[model samples]
Target: MTKSGNVLQKINNNYDELSERYNFTILPRSTRWNSVNRLGFSSTYLIRQGRVIEAIEVAELYTEYQPKSWQAYESLAKAFEANEDNLQALKNVKIAVRLVDNEVNKSLLLAYINQGDRVNMQLRSVKSLTLICLMLFLMVLTACNNDSKLDFDAFVEKKLTDFLIEENAQVASIAIVNDKLNYQKQFGEFPDGTKPHHDTVYEIASITKTYTGLLLAKAVVDKKVQLDEDIRVYLQDGDYQNLQHLGKPITLRHLATHRSGLPQDFAYTSADIKSGKAFELFSNYSEAKFFEDLAQYQLTSMPGETFQYSNVGANLTGYILENVYNQPLSTLVAQLITEQSGEEHTRFRLEPSEISKITRGVDRNGKIAPLLSPHSFAEGGLTSTAASIADYMQYLLSTQAEEVLLSRTLLTETSSEHGHAFFWNTYEYHSANPMFYHSGGSIGTSTWLALYPKQKLGIFIATNVSANNTQGKLNDIANAIVEKYEQVGQSK
Candidate 1:
């Protein structure tokens, strides 16, 4: 075995021993060369040895072994912090603080909690500093070397290439659309070293939500359903009295805006998802099983009052739409979206012959991951090519259809700069120059789509490697492209 593989195996063995002893409980005060202690020491040693990736792996394994232990979470948080993943560090530390029972432990965890704000401030400060430095460096480079200035296309290619290398990603497909440009490109290759083309297929994942939102808008425009109508009215299977909280029934709008007061998934917790049990359950999941779970689901808050991203809610919305239209989601998407957009290769279902065009995806651990199949069609499960997405972006950019407009209208505003429009996230809300965006992730793919309505600009990026930070990296790439495009426009 390779050196890294040996290290991973040792970590796994330590975790297994730890799990056998603790059994997912809080760690005791006394620790003397126990499995936990060994594992923790191993992680720390890795970090000290400048192996932050392996340190993170060990810490992640420890957390998975002892999920309820504050110490495990704290270790994971520190590992992430050392790796400069402040967002994940903050998240894990917050969970550690919540899980800590004793006052002494709580006090120790509170220090990390206090650092969250400092981390955020530092991130903002670093971004500002980086921007200033970049501008200054660019100015100097332009003065010194006239040929150093990169065009928008070259800038995108270089940035995406760097991103792929840094993220250890296999493939990236991107599209940018506007009045002056319709651009699409694919970078990197499959595990077999075969290069992808513009028409190479990829799972768009939750970007499918935007299409579902548009379908909902179409239903409203056609007078088939009311946004505020009780969703229970359409559910014909069982009496779901537990669906409502404080007498507020979940509305279609609530589902679209992720305010439906539903659990994130139908039958699994976060732990189950991390352990791959949720995916196993989803493999054989049927419509009947979905409704069965829904009937038993109790609302955590009043519908439309709280925002919680719920795959179950999204799927339920799709099911309701299916019932309203007397057609499947695949058909509705074909009729309303792909056909209208002239996205010939975009669909929920692909023919057997076309499946080969779908590029393979790699997981964070460098293993080939299974291609996601359609389960919740509305929440995710759409496949398309960069060229097809480019065409779709152009359609969205130019179309003045009522449904499209309604889909872009703000449904819920969380702040002056942020809001939800149907299923799309609206940024720069109060500024009138709204940008609609959404990110998508399946087991092994990540995607981001952004639309600047006033500017008539659209950007879509996708990678065949899904990691914790993949979507953020894609967002960064998209933003860089936009900045370069704007700069080019200003210069002209």
Candidate 2:
């Protein structure tokens, strides 16, 4: 490891210890300033230590801790540029450019602006050359120029159609580019010939974990919770007495990264699932019951010693946040994500008017399926439209929300090649600049969220029907779309 990497690892190792030592009894303005400076120092240290993703994450935390500081925004912009997210880099630098009064930093920001402009100019030139070549080819091969105009709309439509046909079902897809949603399409139809509308909602199973992750990051920003603190602190003294793994208490970070060693579900039996009633299985599952079962649970390994995907772990984090914020998970999600991002159609509990927009899931045999309720609300209970999910994704792509959402926080060797964030899994698409993604599946529905932070690009897909290979289909579609954009960029 590089010297920077060594320092970063050391920071990670001592993070909890230092937090407990210094900020345990966080007081008034002075302590808050001290906390902000500590975060700023960490952010700068990551940058100097050459940990790009970690730097970006901590830089974002610094900005949240001190939003008015032009220096903080400037630092964040540099981090974005270092990560090759030139668009966001330019955006932040421009903000910093306006905020700074002194000439020194202003000149530095202007230099970054100029460099960004040069890259944009090259891209524009490539696009123009591509258009010229296409025109020339069409004119020369009038007999065989099969519409080489690169109609992104048609390309996406065909991909969706092929995917739905392969799965033998129906799907809803929305595509966003440059922060604006430009395409909305539906494939196949219900038995009643009811086509999906723009507002069609689907149960976005594990994608709900991303919302929980957001709430966790938000709670940290609000200073209501800390990532490294043992979650037992939030519960009553004896509620989770049996929750520790060999003497190590599970922290929120472990839970979010799926290394808490907690099991994937409650002790609910197969009989509970066979009951054919949603509430009977989990809808009304109470937090008290959750702790009751947790008190009897055993760990497979010590906390943070292994990567074990755990729905119950995420649910427990949500429960802890509820304890800290004194609000339901639904309300916290609305406040932190949906309302904040203007995603009007995403919620755990839907209003009466919005109920009709739900695209009921279909089984493998093409029959309408029963709704699914997971072990807890935080596990897999949120519903959203392609547009609404796209809106939330747009917020992420915009880099206007929490940077923790996009940061490469964990280095676990998951099925995905890159790593994992809180709930988002990272994949190596075309470069070291890995793409972040998360897919969800319930009884009869599937959803996917993917973004290339470096490119400031993303795609959202939600389908009402679930098949054995739906996740593969979603991956294929997302990859194809990203490749299409890369091709366009290369053409320019």
Candidate 3:
């Protein structure tokens, strides 16, 4: 076996030992490896390690052993490029993208090669070029998330009490994006609980995944990527799995919707995530690491089979987006979602550098903890005011400018979006009729948003601390408001 193959075997063995703790899932046959794209795998590792020829040889192997594997072909192209063999790389990339058939991977291959050298692919569109932010912006406009000038700005400051602020919650800014609005709110100290300020940020944990979901959708619209294709074609070459047991051939859509069968982030202790701490569990993880782990993850269920929440699954979605854009996930957020969402005021980190610009997260106990960053923003690494969060909902729920910024064609089946997390769907609470929305919570922050597209109604709330039973309280509040809106709508 090649040294790379040997290392993979050792890693597999170590992972097997680690699985003794939980009920381990067996790798499926389709994903099972034996010697399909050996050339592609070798070439990929070599290129990553800065070795050119070995990488080329790796790509060549795909042509020999697994003539069908696009991974080998893409690697061949990449290896060629690294070796300055641009011609060969161009020749193979065409075969790779068509063969692999994944949107993100196709984007990656496209990004790696030059236009003149490309093998006969058609040009992409302008709107598709800026799909993430631009597409959503247009899609949301259709939802009637339109905002009106608020005389309440004066009311909030003049008629309201400083209750949350006096309790240590720092109120940042208030913004309105149509019927949805967000407030800039922050609270408590920094890491280890020190003197805190207004701009203290908090790790958003799983919220990062929601943003990743949006990116997936945008990629589809851009045509820079597709969601209905096999994932192997987009991935770096290695041994095993040839799409036989991929559960239904995991697609970008499946991954975005959390049905791709990837696991949540590696099961690791908190201390292990920290560097130099314990040779940690999730220590070897970053975007690249995420894809590697994904290649090994077992498909407990088939694609679109069922709903199972997994961080690693979501992380892979973000990772794929990054691979296609040739930019970091954080950068993608800044350019696409953050900029277009107009939640530009919102930042994705858990620090207290800005005294008047951050929000603190609280748990069920309502106790404060340290902040977090957008490193995992694809899951939950964002802090924003209730108003800003609501504004985001506008894009999701609005019907006014559907075809403009928030296209109606994007989400026709509301039920598909309603399953677990974000995506407009109805759930009942406090005997209130169905309300479509999502909730977010962490160490010292509690956020809730509700949108009734049918009624053109919405509500947003973000607290610096989690209210143990306040969820019921918010539900009560939301239902009450939604009910009132319904009654008013009927009368009209």
lDDT of 1 by residue, 181-287 (tens): 56677788876778888878888889998989999999999999999999888888777998888887888989999998898877667888788787777766788
Error of 2 at 94 (Å): 20
- TM-score of every candidate relative to the true structure: 0.68, 0.65, 0.51
Whichever of 1 and 3 has more TM-score, that candidate is 1
Candidate 2, number of clashes: 2
Give one clash count per candidate, in the order shown.
0, 2, 82
lDDT of 3 by residue, 1-492 (tens): 322334334435654442332112322213213323333444556677786765665456456443435666766767776786544555576566455523445555554443524332222534324333432443343222212112233233331224344334433222222232223323223446564332233333444455666666566666667767776656555632833254458776566556666655564445553442322333334655654555566665666676555666666666667777778777777666654443434556434455235555554444554344323446666665444454455555542332223321222232533443232223442223344555555545555556555544556554555545533444554455445434433212
Which stretch of 10 consecutive residues in model 1 shows the poorest summed lDDT? 24-33
lDDT of each: 0.75, 0.67, 0.48
Worst 10 residues of 2 by lDDT: 23-32
Q: Which stretches of candidate 2 lie over 4 Å from their true place?
A: 1-150, 237-239, 267-280, 350-356, 373-376, 402-408, 411-416, 429-431, 490-492
Give one digit per residue, the lDDT tens place, for model 2 in 238-315.
Answer: 756666867888888888889888877774555665665543656566777788888888876888888877889988
Deviation (Å) of 407 in candidate 2: 5.6
